[model samples]
Structure formats: structure tokens, C-alpha cells
Target chain A: MRHGRRRGRLTRVSSTKDKLLDATVETLRTHGIAGVSARTIAATAGVNQALVFYHFGSVDQLLAAACATATAQRVEVFHERFAEVGSLRELLAVGRELHTVERGTGHVAVLAQLLAGAQSDPRLGEATAAALDMWARELETVLDHVLRRTPLAGIADVAGLARAAAAAFIGIELYEGADPQGAGSALDALDQLGAILEAFDDLGPVASRALRAKVRQVTSK
Target chain B: MRHGRRRGRLTRVSSTKDKLLDATVETLRTHGIAGVSARTIAATAGVNQALVFYHFGSVDQLLAAACATATAQRVEVFHERFAEVGSLRELLAVGRELHTVERGTGHVAVLAQLLAGAQSDPRLGEATAAALDMWARELETVLDHVLRRTPLAGIADVAGLARAAAAAFIGIELYEGADPQGAGSALDALDQLGAILEAFDDLGPVASRALRAKVRQVTSK
Candidate 1:
């Protein structure tokens, strides 16, 4: 009888923890970082405020957990899509799709809040960076696969390109909030770059050789 | 004597306001957005907390004023240098110099906090975006001048490029906090892009025409 009751309690605890995480993300989406607190999160979760401290030790820890958990889930959902990206342009197309869905789901707002909160909290910054890295790592894999066939193969730093691409998307996401037209233009510019790369890839062997030599000569300088 | 005293009083009031503005920026630099308050700003300014409200009406107003005032001064300082940029490579070089200087002066940190704070605050968002526009405008002018001679002049969107460049830098600055090496790579990637543009400028007429046509074709598609 005691074992059965303990098992039931364990399930309840796990469910409450999940509820708290969801509530934290929701609060960040709706209230921004400033609106987040144990009271608010617990209220959103429909549980006692003490459970936050009990489960996560503090609100900051809960925030970090929530961000990491949510990002992991989101990244998992896109893993196959990211794997299917065959070209730089296709990668960008996926990015656009992801951006649209993330914006609609209010995850973009949640990201902004976490990034803002991270500035003031080191623990949160570490967690936020970790979450960001998950995306960067996925991008790096694709970049490695795609760039290997391009003139930029060895010359470009694939790792850096991955982070840069991730960062650019993050910046555009936030920038869109302030200047939608400018953001759209930035997106278009990226597409243009993608198209240019595709054109480079389409070059005949002799032209490709010449282009590679030129790219090498310029980058080396 | 009465007129002299009135002028002296006006000078003191202006000086106090300046002190508050400077303090607000300092507070943001050191404490992040979460640490900013009338109490903190006044403490940093060595004035009574009431002075913050008395001069700027509210903490948010003070932050907006400080961001605008500081950005204007920084942009003004760079006006001559920006005008001297004769090439995309030079512009990137200037961007590097500016990044280093801004990072050293803690303005980058302030920018991060403002961007974060802006996520939740519409008024702050307006002020931050306006400040960002100041940089974008400067970049747009330079892009117009440099790209005018390049194949990309009519093809690329200069206005969008300016905002994109500005956003990229902003993203890079923030991303640097999470991954310094990756940030360096991103900067190098930009430099590579600049070098490519420079190389395109060095192309012989026939090659340039061919490249331009190819670019147009790809972009049109």
C-alpha cells in the first residue's frame, strides 16, 4: 500500500514539474522577463508558489530549465527537416518556415525574454547559450555537408558560419519587431546570397576553377 | 544680478540632467536592465532618486533619453570615419574598429540590456530601434557610395543591406558573449564577403559584365 502511494506521489511530482516548465515559458511569452516570478509562474501553473522553489530551487533555475527544455523539444521537432536541407537556399527556406512557426507560437517572445534576462543572470546566460548552441550545432552539420561541394568548402569556417547564420537569424527575428520592412529586406539579401552560391555551384568546371582561384587569392590577402 | 542668477540656475539644472543621463547609461552598463531603477540611476549619478523622475519623468524615459543621447554622440564621433570608407573592405575594417571600441567602453553591454529590455517595453523598443537606425543610416550612406561602383549597386538593396549589416553586427556582439571564437569566425566570414566584393571590383570589364549578368539572372530566378 505504501509503495503504491509513493509511486502515485512520484507521478504527481513529475507532472507538476512539467506544468511549472510550461508555465514558465508561457509567462515569459506573455509577461516578458520582467513579469516572471514564482508567484506568476505558480499562478500560471495553477499550483502552489512553494512548488517552484521546491522543484527548481529558485525562479532563475526554473527559467533556465524551462528554456533548455523547450529549446530541446523544438530542436528535436526540426531535426529531420534540418537533415533534409540539401542546399544553402533550402536551409534558408527551412529557417523561414521555422521563423514563421516560432513567431506564431510566441517562442520568439520567449527567446527575447530569456536573452534579456540572461544579460542580468549568469546562470541564465549559460543555459541560454547552451540552448542556442543546440541550433548552431544542427546548422554546423548541414553547413559541413553543403559547403564541401562548393568553392567555399575549405576556405570558409563552417563552424563560424553556423554560429553566424544562427546569430543572423536571431538578430533578424528581433529586428523584425522593430523594423519589419528592413527585416524582410535582410531576409531577401540572404536569399540573394544563397542564389549567388547556387549560381557558383552551377558554374562549368573551368569557370569554377577560375572562381575558386579568385576566392582563394582574395581571402588569403 | 537677478538675470545672472537665473542663467546660473539654468546651467545647474542642465548639468544635473546631463549627470542623470550619463548615470543611467553607466547603470545599464554595469547592472544590466534588471538592475536599472530610479534608485540605481540616482545612486550612480550621486543625486537623490527624486531627481531622476524630476528630470526625465520616469525611469523608462530616462533610459530612452540616455540611449538616444549616447548613440548620437557615438555616431557623431564616427561620422568622419564613416565618410572616409571608400570600399566595402574599409567599411568592414571600420566596423571591426568600432566593435572593439564599443566592447571596451561597455556600450555593447548596454546595447544588449536595452535590446533585452526593449523586448518587454514598447517605449524602450522605440528608442532602441531609433538608435539602431542611426547606425543603419550611417551604414546606408556608405553602402550607397561604395556599391555604386560595384556590380551589386543596382542589384542589391542598399537600404536593406544597411539594416542587415547593422543587425548582423548587433547579433554578433551579443553572440560573442556566448561564443567568442564563433563570433570571431562570423566577423571573418563578413570580411570574406567584403574581400569577394573587392575582388569583383578588380575583375576585368568582360568578367565583371558576365558576373553582373549571372547575378541578375540568379537573383531574378
Candidate 2:
């Protein structure tokens, strides 16, 4: 409890904890939630098995901590980049990159694992909810900007729009992971919307409408 | 080995198998994949524990069969009804209904449980992929008809549009289920789109564009 002297032990404790957490995440990524056990995690961390109980108390606690830590890290990776985007189109591109496992945050697979277990495990469910809430909060800001600049403004509830778009981004990732063709069609449609929105923004309202009539005539064929 | 002689036991055997499968689905709903076991399912089905393996060979095979059967039944519940919808508006409404746990298919929760395990288990992953494919195929047909009737038709790749829409529908459901706000925002935005599209369809292309511009002007203020 001595202020300066215990600081050394605290540092040692924190580092050991970090290593254990890292091993837990690695296990989740490679073996999944079911594969995570004190033995395997300690083996992966190269720590004495007793140290796991000393640090985290149980495998479940270690997993919950791993999920929080991994989710927080992923949020940091995307948050800085997404917050800087000036338009909806840029956000979608970043989202596309983040959703794919081979390309970006492999968090989706881990998230799916948590979500599945969350329905039955209250602690895991709360963790899953907190992670989703983090996403929804970030998206609301971007959608506010996109709506204010576009011809589609006032078209719906802004809050709802943000949530829906956020949901679609996640939905795309989950479906793609399962489907392999992924959301190729949905992303294509999104790209078209970005192009159209960019063009329509430059055209002004009256001209944009006039252009739509022409676009309809062409697309209708 | 004669085909006709064992038919009586065949009928009783198959009935017992069906009951075990039904118990598996119910257990998945109440407890989750991790909670499924011969003991739990046999108790739920009011049968002897050995009967589980005797009927399905193993707990894993029983769970897989349960997933497939439940998914097929849910798909049947929504499929023909969706195929008959007259417009995008109707499709969205139906999709919304099908996504929720209380109001629609409880498959979302079951699917979530499967997807979580799918990452670690090759067999579970394959089963999940097949189930999702069934959903996408049905949604594609509905979107094809909706796109054909709307001004948005031919604006982009119809296949992608269908897939993206299907993804969004799914994304909304999953997020809502996890978050507990119930997809209010996503659904609200969808309803707005439905309103806008319905209005646009009736107004003719030129007028609809004019109306959208006016909407922008109002929203911009």
C-alpha cells in the first residue's frame, strides 16, 4: 500500500495482466470462445497457471476482459479514421475495409462469438451491447453530416437513419463472413449512391430533379 | 432386411427422432448451443438419455439437424408471404416483422448462436452458410419484383440491391436484438423511404425530384 514502493509491483502486475489478456484474445481469434480455458490461455501466455487465477480469477472473467480490450482497440483503430471523413462515401469505403477479415478488423468473428453466447450469458450480453453502442454513437455524427449536405435530407428520422446505416454496415460484415460473396451487391449499390449523391450535390436541387428524369429514362431501359 | 417388415418401428423411430430434434431447438432457444447436451435434450423430450445418440448418432448431429429443421421452418413461415408482397413498402414491413424475436422469427437468436460457434467449428460454419443462403435467395426474388416496380429500378445492380437490402434487413434485426432499443431508428428511416418512394412513384419522376429538392430546402433550414 506504500505509494512509491508498491508502484513497482503494480507495474509488474499490469504487464503480466496485459500478457494474459493478449493470450486470451489470440485464443479467441484462433480457437474461439469455446477453446478459451485457463490452461490454454496460460500455456499461450507462458505464465504459471496459478498466475491466471491471481490476475483474473477465472477464465470467464479473462474472456470478458479480453473482449472489452480487443473491442476497445478495434474501436480506436477505426474511430480516428472514420471521424475525419468529410462525407458519407468515404465512411462507407472505410467501413468496407473494416468489415473484411483478411483486410481489416477481424473483430466481427470474435463479435459473432460473443453475440451468440451473450443471449444466454448476461455478462457477455452486456459486453456485446456496450460494443454496439460504441459503434452507434460514432455513426450518428457522420450521418448528421451526410444528411445536412445531401438532397436526401429530411427524408427520414436522422437518428433512425444513423442506426440503420450502422446496422447495415455490421450486417454486411456478418453476412459476408457467412456468405463468402459477402455483401458484394450491397456495397455496389452503396457505391452508386455515393456517386449519385456527389453528382446531385453539385447540380443543385432544380437541376438534380431534371437530371433524375433523364436518369430514370436511361435506367428504365 | 425386408423393407415392409420393420415399417412399424420405422414410424415410431422417426417420431422419436422428430421429438428429440424439437427438444434441441427449444434448448437452443432457452439455453444456447453451449447449453445443448444429451442430458438436457432428453429431459426436455421426456425420453431416456441414451435415446438421443440412438436416434441421431451424437449430440453434434442432433444439434445440426435441429438447426437445419428450425431454419427451414422459419423460412417457410416468411417465404411465400414475402413472395406475394406488391411493393418495396410491403417487403420492408415484412422484413422488419421477420427480424425481431418477439414479433417475428426467433431464428435470429438461434442463428447468432450458430454463427458464434461457426468460426471455430467447420461443420457449424457450413451449416450457418447454408441457412443464410436460403434467406438470401428468397429475399432476392422479392427485391427483384420491388425494383421492377419502382423509379429506383435499374438505377443500380438489381442483384446487389437485393443483397444489400437483405443485409440491411438482417443488420437491423441483429443490432436491435442485441441493443434492445428494438431497431426503432432503422425501421423509422425505412418507413420514411417507403413513404418517399411511394410518393415519388405516384408523382412521376419530374415532380418527385422537385419535391425532393423542396424537402432539402426545408431540411436545410
For all the models shown, what interface RMSD does each have?
Answer: 2.6, 7.5
Please provide, for model 2 over A73-189, each residue's C-alpha lDDT reduced to its tens digit, 9 standing for 90 to 100: 777777777777887668767766676642344676666556655667777767777877666677777777776766655443567766777677766666666665746767776
For candidate 1, what's the RMSD?
4.9
Poorest 10 consecutive residues by lDDT, candidate 2 chain A: A1-10
True contacts kept of each: 0.43, 0.55
Write candidate 2's Cα lDDT for B71-133 as tens digits. 787888777788788887788678666765433435666665565556667777677778777
Error of 1 at B190 (Å): 2.1
Model 1 chain B: worst 10 consecutive residues (lDDT sum): B1-10
* Model 2 residue A17 lDDT score: 78
Question: Candidate 2, residue B77: CA error in Å?
Answer: 1.8
With a 3 Å backbone cut-off (N, CA, C), the pairs that clash in candidate 1 are none
lDDT of 1 at B96: 92
